[model samples]
Target: MANSDNNNKTAWQMATQVIHAGSGHDDPHGALAAPLYQTSTFKFANTEQGSARFAGEEGGYIYSRLGNPTTHELETRVAVLEGYDAAAATATGMGAIAATTMAFVKAGDHIVVSDAIYGCSFALFSELFERFGVHADFVDLTDADALTTALKDNTRLVFLESPANPHLKLVDIEAVSQILAGRDIKLIVDNTFMTPLLQQPKQLGADLVIHSATKFLNGHGDVVAGIVCGSADDIALIKGTTLKDMGATISPHDAWLILRGLKTLDVRMQRHCENAEKVADFLHKHSLVRKVYYPGLAEHPNHSLIGTQMRHAGAVIAFELDGDEAQSRYFLNQLQMIPLAVSLGDAETLIQHPASMTHSPYTPEARQKAGISDTLVRIAVGLEAAQDIIADLSQALQSSQQRWQRSA
Candidate 1:
C-alpha cells in the first residue's frame, strides 16, 4: 500500500517507488491494487464540501476530468520518478506538449526552442504558435552561443530535449538552466527519451519535465498518454486551466496501465541499454552503415555528456545509410523480425526511416538543417536477444546494399 503522503516517496529507491509511491490507496472493497474509480463524477458530502473541493481548500474527487483517485496514483508515482512536486497526465503524449505550451505562454511572447525535437512539437511551435501571435526560434541548442543569441527579451520559455529525438543531439540542461537562473523564463525539458530511470531533468535544474508516456512510461505500446511534472503551483495552474479548459485529462484505465508498466521500468531499461550497446557496435562495423548516432558510442559527439546526465546510452539509435533513400526504404522493408513502425519504446524492436516517416513534416532543406538525412534510419532497439537483433539488421543491410549495387 502507498503512504498517501508525498514524503513517503523520498525514503524509497526508484524500484520501490513504482510499487509503493501511491500505495496507501484505499478502496471500499479493500483491493490491494489501486482501484479504478471508473465513474465520471463523485458525490459531494454537502455544499461546503463541494465548494471547498472546487476552491482547492480540500483534496477529494469531484469529477474524473478534474481528478480521480486511480489517476492520482499514476501522477504521484510519475512525480516521484521525475523528482518533481507534482505531475499531470494527459490523453496523449502530444497533449502534454500542447497543454504545457498553452499553460505557459500566450500572445506576444517568444520561445527559443531546440532544433532536434519531435515532429509534432515542431508543428505545434511553427504552425499553431505562429497563428496566435506567439513567436518561436528553432536553433541547434548544442551551440550555446546560438541559443543565447536567439533569446529575446520577450522569451517566455526555453524548451529543449536532451539526446534529442532521431539524431540524439544533446542539450546541456544544467548549463542552459544556469543561463536562465536569474531571469523570469522557465526551462522545460522533454525527458521522453531518457525516462527518469536514466535521467531526472528536474534534478539538473529543469523547471519542468515532460514525457511521452505513450512511448516509455506505458512500455507495452498498449496505451497512449503523456506526463508533465513540475512545481505544485505550476501544475495546479495547468490542471485548473490549460488541461481542464482544453479537455486533455488522461483516462483512468490508461493511468492504471502506466502504473503497471512502471513496476519493471528499472529492469526493462537495463536490458534496453544492454541490447542497444551491442546493436550499435554491430552497426558501426557494418560497411553499409555510414554513421550511428547513439551516445553510448565513443564516436558520438555527445558521448561524454551522456555520462554527465544519463545513467545509460538509451535504447534508440539513428544511423545513416551509405546509399540513398531508396536503399534506406529497401533496408526497412527487408527487415524480417523487427517491424517497420513509427512510435518507439516498444517491447518489440521497431525500426523506421525518419526522412520519409517521422520527420516527413520537414522539407529537404529543413531536414538537413535539423541533422536528419534522407538516408537516415532510426532503430528503437527492444528487449530481443542482442544476437537476434544484430542478425536481423545485418541481413537487412546486406540485402539493401546488394539491391542498390545491382541497380547501379
Candidate 2:
C-alpha cells in the first residue's frame, strides 16, 4: 500500500505519519493491518512483464532481495517520517552504514568521522575499510576547526553521530553541514540515538540520514534493521549497487515487524524522553555518580544545542561512577531492575560498560582520545516508572559505595 502520490502532497505531522504514513496500501482482503508479503520472490504475469521489470521499464517486484512490498512500505513510512525523498532498509545498522558509504566512496576516497562513535562503526572505518584502501580521519566533530583541518581534497563523506554512543557528546549538525555545503563531500548523520521524533538530520542540511531501526525505530528491540534516507537518486544508486551486490537486504518479516512498531513510535518516544530526563536528573544529583553525560542536563557542554539540533536530550544517558572500573562493574551487577546489556532504545532499561563491551573494538588509547572512560556506564532509560528506576539505581549506587569503601 503506501500511496506515494498522496504522501508526497500531504504534509502529515509525526504522530499522524507514524501510524498512517504508508496508508492507502492496496490489500486484497482490506485487512486493518498492513499485509505482510513474506515470500522470497514475486510472480510475474508473463515473460514480457518479467523482462520489463528486469529492464527497469516496469514497476512490480521480481525478487524479494531486489524489492518487497512489505519492505517498501517500511521504507516509504520511514522516508516520509524523516522528510526525505527516498529510503532503503538494510539487514542491520552496520549494513546501512556500509551500504550508504560504499555506494558513494571509491578506493582512493577519504572520510571524516566523529571521534566518538559506535564500536562497530569505528572498527568498520579503522579496521575493515582501511584494508580496502579507503581511509578515515577520526576527529572531535565538536571542534569546528578540527573538522575543517581534517577535510581533504579527496574527502567524499563526513560522518558523525550526534549525542554520540556511550558518551552523549553532541555535534553541531547545522554547522558541520554548512562546512561541507559547497563541497562535493556528503554529510552523513547517524540518527540512531535521536530518532526522527527528537531530531531529523535531513532537515538541518545533512545530505543523508542513517538509523539503526533495531533501536528506536522498532522500539521493541525485536528487529535488527537499519535505514538510510536521502535524495531519490542517491537511494536508487545505493539500492542498485551496494544493497544489491553486497546482499545486506532486510527480511520481509523484519520489515513487517518494524512497520508494526512504528504505530506506537510517538507515544514510546515521548515516554522515553520523559523517563530519561527524570533518570538523568536523579543520577546528576547522586553523590556516587561522577560525571553524567546527557544532553538533558542544563550543565551539559552541548546543552545549548538542545532546542536547535534536537527536540530533547533523548533516552540514552552515559555517566561515570565515583570509583574505578571495579566499582563500575559491581554497580552494574548490583542493579536488580535494569539489565546489564548492550543495545539501546528498548522497552526494558539496559545498561553496559562501553570500554569493555560496545566500544571494546577501540584500543585503550583510542578510547581515551574519544573520551570513553573505563568506568563510563551507558543506560538506555525505558518506559518503566521513573520512581522505580530511580529506586533501583539508588540501591545499587548505595550498595556499590559501601562495598568499595569497605574494600578500600
Candidate 3:
C-alpha cells in the first residue's frame, strides 16, 4: 500500500494492472487465482512477531479484521486501477461509504451531499449520521450556484456521485475541486456507476473514491462487496478504526469472487456500453417512451462528459413511460426477458421502478425535486444480444400503451 518509488516501478497499464497488481501468490500449492485464506486470524512465527505486528513494527497481519491476504489482493488491484495509494475492503457498498465518511467526521461535523444519490446513501446521511449530531445538506451538484450556497465553515466532507443513481446528471469534478481548493474539505465521490476503468475520479481531484463492488466492478453481480481507495494514511485510518470497530470486513471467499470478476472488467464494460447504446436508441424512438436518460444519447445534459471523464456511456438507462405508475407496473409485468429486480450491474438484464422501489427512501418532496417521477423506469442493460434486449422492451412498450392509452 506504500506510494513510494518502489510501488511506481510496479505500476502497469490498467488492463495489465487488473491481472497483476500487487499479486504475489506465494501459496505453496501454486494455485493460479488468489487462494482463499478464509480464517478469522493469522498466526505469527512467535510472540515477538505478534507484538511487533500489534505495535506497527512488523508488516504481518495479526487478524482478519486488520488485514487478510485475499482481501488485500483485491484492495491492491482496485487501488491501482483507481490511481490511489491504498484501499480497504468492506462487507457491502454501504459499509465502504460508512467507514470512509465516519473516519473523517464525528459529532458536530457538517457534510454536503449530492441532491440525488443511491437511496441507501441518502439514508446513510439522513437516517444514521444525522441522528448522531452530524448535519448534512443535499444540493444540486450540477449547478455552481447551489454548490456555493451549500458550503459552510464547519463543512468537513463533500460527497457526490456523477451520473448519479436513477438519474444521469454530471457534476463537473475539476470545477468543484477548484472551488474548495483552499478549504479543509474532503471530496468523496461514489464511483459505483462508473468504475475506475471508465472514470478516474482521483485524476479529476477527488480526495476519496467509493465503490459498490457488487456492481460493475464485480461485473457478474455474484458478490456484494465494497471498496474505498485513497492515500495510504487515509486508508490505514479506516482500516485501523472504523472498519475494525464497525466490523464490516468482507469475507475472504467473497473477496476472491470479486477478484475473479475484476480480471474481465475491461471487456465486460465494453460489451455493456455497446449494448446500452443500442437499447437507448430503441427506447428513444419508441412511441410509448417519453424521454431516455442514457448519456450515450446526444440529447443528454451530460453527454459530452462521457468521453471526457469516462471511457463510455455506462449500461444503466433511465426513462419515463407515457403512463402512470400503475401502467408502468403493467409494463414490468409484461416484460418477457428482462427481470424485474432491484439491484443492477448483473450479467442478465434487470429493471425496476425507482420511485416505488430503490429511491423510495427519499421523501416525496426530495424525490420529486430529483426528477424521479412515479413513472420513471430504471433499466440496467445487460450483456444480452442487442436484438433480444430491444425485442423484449418493444413488446412491453406496446403492451403498456394498450393498457394506458386514454384521455391524453
Candidate 4:
C-alpha cells in the first residue's frame, strides 16, 4: 500500500504542501531547508545494513547517482503536486523522455505521438528510436481520428504535449485518455508547458506525466531538471530499471533550486497567464500579424476545449507575420525588451523564430505540417508589465511592416 501521509490531498493542498513538504523536519541539526548530499557514495552503518540496502530489504541511500535526500524531496513534491503515487527526477527534460520511453518499449513495440511536440523530442523519436527498431507514428493530436488510426496492435505508448511548443496547439487530455482507456498502451503527456498548477494530466486519466522542470516548474531558468510522475508500480518499474541503467539522475543542488522555484509557482503562473493574454490581444490586433495562436482567444480552434481542460491560457503564445524570413529577422532585431533566445519559461520575456531555431532540424514540409511556419514567432510572456510588453511588440511589428513595404 502507498504511504498514508501523502494521500487524499487536493491540488490546492498539494501546492501548499510544496512549500513545506518532504524532509523539512528530519534534520537533527535543526536545518530548515534540505541540505544537498553531494557525496558520490554513502557510508554504510554496517556490512549487514549495506547488504540489506542493496537487497531492497531496507530503504536508504546507497549512492548519490541512484538517489539522494534533496532529489527525493523534489520528486516527492512533484509527485504530490501532479497527483501521482510517486515520481522520479532526471538530469534533464530529454533524459526523462528517453528514460520513460526506453522503460516502456522494446524492439517489436510501436509508438504513436503528436506531430507538434518539442523539436528535440520529435527528433529523438524519429531519428534515435527508429534506429533502434521501434516504429513511431506521428499524427496531428487535435485530430482524434488520426490518433486512433495511428494506433497499432503492437502500440505500447502514446505521447502528447498539450499547447505544444512553438505553435501553442491544444490537445484534449481527457479526450485522448478516454480513447486509450483499458488498453495496454500507456498515455504519456509532456506537461512542461502547463505545470501542475495549471494542469494535472494524471487526474484526467493519463498513465504518466513528464515535465521539463527547466521550464515553468523551475520558473527561474537556472536549473535543468526533469520529472516523471505516475502510479507507484509504474514509478518503481522505471526507477528500478531505466533510471538506474541510464544514469541521468538530477544533482542535489539543481533539485534544491527547483524546490525553491516551486514555492511561488501559483503566483508566477497567474502572472504569466495574465501577461500572455495581454500580449496575445496585442498581437491579434496588429496589422502585420497574419495569425495569432493562443487558447485565451475565442477564435482559436481549440479555445473551448482548452477552457474545459486548462486552468488558464498559459504563458506561451505564437503568431505568424505577413512577410518571409527577412521580415521576421528585422522584427526580431527591432525588439528591445524581449530577448532573442531558444528556451522559455523564465522571469523575463523571451522570443524565438521556430522555423529557423528550435524546429530547424525538421524538413520544411514536416515543419509546415506541424504548424511551424517560416514567419512564425513564439513569445514566452514573462512577469514584465503587460503595457511595456505590448509597447515593445508594437515597435517591433511597426518596424517589420515598414521593412516589408520597402522590400515590396
Candidate 5:
C-alpha cells in the first residue's frame, strides 16, 4: 500500500486505507503488519539517485526524521480524513502547532489567537512568541467580531480551538473564515476536540488543521503524537523548512500505534458522543449544578452554530457547582469511577477541576473571564455505562453539598 497512489480515493474509502495504506506487500517472511523502519538513515541506490531525492527531482525516503514509510502512511490517511492535499505527523501535538506557526509567521508578524486554548498553547503565544519578535493577541473566539477587530496590518495568522479545552466553548469557524476571506491571514484550528470525523476545518475554509493524536486519534491514551493537514504547498513548506530544521518528527512505532488506533476511531467516537450526552443531561438536572456546558444541550449559547459546523457534539462537558473551591475539591475527591486526571479523549472516563488543574496557570481574573470558575468541573466522558457515570457524579455532588453546608 505504501507504493499505491491514493490521489483518487474518497474520504470513507480512506478510513479503510488507514489499516492497509502504509505497507507494501508483506516481506517474504510473512510479516503482516507494517514493520517499523527504525533506522536513522537510508541507503541510496546510487549517489546520483540520492542527489535527485535531495534536490526534489524524485520522491524517496532519506532519513527517518525526514520521512518513513510507516509515518507516511499515517500522514496520507490523516490528510484524506481531513480533506487536505497533504499532511505531516509530529512527535507531539505542540510540535505540530510550533512547526505550523513557524512555517508561516516570523519576526515582526502578528497572530490572533483564542484566549481559551490549551493552557500550554496560551503560554507559548503569550510568553515565548513575544521573545522571538512575533506578537500574539488572545481574544474570546466565540465572538467573531472581537477576533476581526483584533487583527492588525501585520497579522498573518488566526489560531483558534473550537469547543475549547475544559470549558467547551464553541467558535464560529465559518464566520471567522468569512471575515478573513480577502485578507492575507491564514486560519489555523486545533481540531483535537472534534477529530476529522466530526469537524473538517479545512472544508470550512481553514488554512490548516492540527490535532493532538494522543487523544481521540489514539483513543486509548497510549501514544503522544500530532498531525497537521493542509494544502500540498503548505505541507511541503513546513516539511522542508520547520520540520527538517526542528527535528520534531513522529516515530515509526508511534505512527503504527496511531494507525492501529484509527481503525476504531469511528466506533469509539460514536460511543463517546452518546455517553457524553447522557452525562450532560444528568448534570443539567442536578440541583447543585449552576450551568451545564455541552453543545448537545439546547441551552448551550453556541448550540445553533455548533449544529451548523460540527457533525455532533463532542465528548467533553463542563458544569459549575453551587459553591467555591472547597466544594469543587470535595466532588473531585468523591468520584469513584472517573479518574481525577488531566488530558482527555480516552477509553475510560476522566474528570478534573479546571480552575485548579487544567487552567490553573491563568490568573484569577483571566480564568473568571473565560468562565472557568472556582466551582467548574470538567468531564471527558468515555465508554463507561452512562448510568454508572451519572451515579458516581450524583454521589459526588451529594457529598460536596453536605461538605458545603457543614463549612457554612
Candidate 6:
C-alpha cells in the first residue's frame, strides 16, 4: 500500500476521511479495500536497495516491526482524522502511552498528570516511571489554579483525559494548553473516550493526541490497539526512539481490523452518543441512582464545554448507586442484558466497577483522592435501542433496591 493523494486534502469531511483516507487501493489488483501486507519482512530489490533503505536513503518499508503497509495506512488515516502531521500505531493503548512518554521524557524529569485517568495509566506514571527517576504529580487538572500551581521548572509533560475514564470527569484541554504555552512543556491528551469524531485535541493546542484504538476506534471488542498523533517531527522522534527500541508495534492483522472498523466509526459514534444520552437521562431520574456523571446532562458540572471542546457528550457514563458496594454488586448481578466487562465501545452494552476493576491499580487512599468512589459504576452505552437499555437498567435497579430493603 502507498499513500493516497486524496487523503492529503484537508477539505474532505470526517465521514469521508474515515472511509477513504490513506486508501488508494493501490495494490496490483486495485482492490477497493486496502490490502494487508502481513509478512514480517519485505524483500529488497537488491543488496544495494536494502542497504539504502537501512541507511535512510530509500523510502519503502524493510521490516514489519519497523513499519508495515497495513499499519502505516492506519497511522496515516488516524493522523489525517486527528489533524496531525503524522501518527504511529502501537500494540496496545498502553504501548501508545509508553512510546509517547518515553520518547520525550528522561530520568529526573517531572510530569503532571490528571488526578483522574485510566487505572493502568495511573500505575504507569506512579510506578513504572518512578523507578526510572521520573516523578509524577497527580493534580486536579480541572482546576486551572491547581494546574498552574503544579507546574515546575522541571515539568516536561502534562497528561490528561477529557471526559476521563471510569469517572467521566472532564479536563479543560484548551485552558491547560494555554497554561503551558511558551513553557516548552508538552501537553499530551488521551482522546480514547471522545474519539476524533467528538473532539480534536490538536485543534485545541495539544502537542500530541492519543487513542486506545481498542475501544471506540475499533467499535468492536475484538481488537486491542492504540495510536498517537502529533507533528511529523515529534512522531518521527517517537518512531526512532521508544517505539523502535521497545518494539510494541501493532500487528498488521489488527491494523487491518481497525481499518475495517474505522469505516463504520462515524455512524457507530453517533449511535453511541445518542444511546448514552438516553441512558444517562434514565439514570438521572431513577430513585436508585444516587448521581449521574454524564456531561450530556444539563446539570453536569462540565456540561458547558460540550459544543466548544467536544461535539457531544460521549458514549461512556458513570454514576453512583444510591446504596453500598454490596448493593452495587447486587444491581450488577441483577442485570440481564449488559455484560460486566472492562473495555467499552462495543456493539453490546458493557459495564464495570472502576474501584474494584479498572482503577484497582490505585491504593484505597489514592483511589479516594482521585474521586473513584466505591459505589461508582461506569457503563459504555452500546448501539442497542435506548428504551431496551433503560428497561434493563430499571429492572435491575428496582430489584437491587427491593433486595436491599428486605435485607435492611
Query: How do the predictions measure up, each by TM-score?
Result: 0.95, 0.96, 0.95, 0.95, 0.93, 0.96
Prediction 6 TM-score vs. true: 0.96
Cα lDDT tens digits, model 6, 1-408, are: 002333223323888899988885469886888898989999998999999999999899999989999999999999999999899999999999999998889998999999999999999999999999999999999899999999999999999999898888888899999999999899999999998888889989999999999999899899999999999999999998899999999999999999999999988988998899889989999888889999889888888888778888899999999889988988998989999999999999999888999999999999999889999999999999999999899999889878988998
Candidate 3 wrong stretches, greater than 4 Å:
1-12, 405-408
| Model 6 local distance difference test score | 0.91
Clashing pairs in 3: none
- Between prediction 3 and prediction 6, the one with superior TM-score is 6
Off by over 4 Å in 5: 1-32
lDDT of 1 by residue, 291-389 (tens): 989988987877777655776788999998887787788888999999999888889999988878888877677788898988888999898999999
- Superposed Cα RMSD, model 2: 4.0
Every candidate's CA RMSD: 4.0, 4.0, 4.1, 3.9, 4.5, 4.1
Q: Give the TM-score of candidate 3.
A: 0.95
Error of 5 at 335 (Å): 1.3
lDDT of 2 by residue, 207-291 (tens): 9999999998998889999999999999999999999999999999999999999999888888888999899999998999988
Question: In model 1, where do residues sit more than 4 Å from their true spots?
Answer: 1-12
- Candidate 2 Cα errors over 4 Å, as ranges: 1-12
lDDT of 1 at 175: 85
Worst 10 residues of 5 by lDDT: 1-10
Off by over 4 Å in 4: 1-14, 23-25
Q: What lDDT tens digits, residue by residue, belong to model 4 across residues 201-222? A: 8878899999999998899979
Q: What TM-score does candidate 1 get on C-alpha atoms?
A: 0.95
Error of 1 at 233 (Å): 0.6
